[model samples]
Target: MLGASTWNADRAQEIVDEHLSLEAPMLPILHALQEEFGYVAPEAAPLLAQALNLSRAEVHGVISFYHDFRHEPAGRHVLKLCRGEACQSMGSEELAEDLFTKLGLDWNRTTRDGELTVEPVYCLGLCASSPAALIDGEPIARLDATTLGEAVDEARGL
Candidate 1:
């Protein structure tokens, strides 16, 4: 997993301040916070709102709207399965369901061992390789349950 630091209000404030000069600082601030802390700390919303002269709701809205912005830290390995029409048509859904069951996880949930977090992505631009997935951002095309399982195991160092 990425070595994200523990949440610190002071550090978060500094990050917000650093980007205050930008024309559109909200996204940058949020990304910075996530980069530092793995996920945007809930406490950050108010700090961002106050710094940017925006409502807390607005800050939160942006956070929630972006699928890439995780509310909680992800597991050591993140498996992003493509769920676009092509992938779905190619049986990604079935493969995903089997993997989810095996891992005892639901979408966006982490495994009990913290080894993996499974997420659904809209597209990976690998339609020709439908049923693709990304393991820690490394694309795996032509995915099957066995291949996906092996990838996850390898990522877990099993």
Candidate 2:
């Protein structure tokens, strides 16, 4: 996983300022902030709203609407499990439930140790290899409980 800096209002403002010239720049600004800080801090909405002349609600709506935009920092590693129809048909729902139980996490939640966060992603474009997952952005296809558990354990450095 890429290292992300702690949230800094000044740095966030710099990011927002850098993207302001772009047409329809809200998404870019949000992405930039996430890239720099690993998540969009709640404090960012007011700053972005002021910079873009938008309402805080408008800025927050965009963040909440997008599944990829996290309001809080994720753990050292992120695991995105596919939940698209293809994967569901291939038993991803059951797999996800079992995994969540084993990890003691709900959706989009981090482990107690802060080593990993598990999120649901719709389709990884691996329909042929249904029930796919991505660990820190690296694709892992043809998943099963054992393989997925092993991957998670490895990511957590177990």
Best by lDDT: 2
Query: For candidate 2, lDDT tens digit of each residue in 1-158?
Result: 35988989888888988988899999999998899999989999999889989999998898899888888899999999999999999899999999988889988888898889999998889999988999998999899999999998887788
For model 2, what is the alpha-carbon lDDT of residue 77?
97
| Cand. 1 Cα-lDDT | 0.89
- Give the per-residue lDDT of model 1 (tens digit) for 1-158: 46778889888988988998899888888888988988887898899889988899998998899987888888988888999999999999999999988888989999888888888999999999889999987999998889989998998899
RMSD of 1: 1.4
Residue 78 in candidate 2, Cα distance off native in Å? 0.9
Per-prediction RMSD in angstroms? 1.4, 1.4
TM-score per candidate, chains pooled = 0.92, 0.93
- The residue-level lDDT of candidate 1 at 130 comes to 85
- Top-TM-score candidate index: 2
Candidate 2 TM-score over all chains jointly:
0.93
Taken over the whole model, the C-alpha lDDT of each candidate is 0.89, 0.90
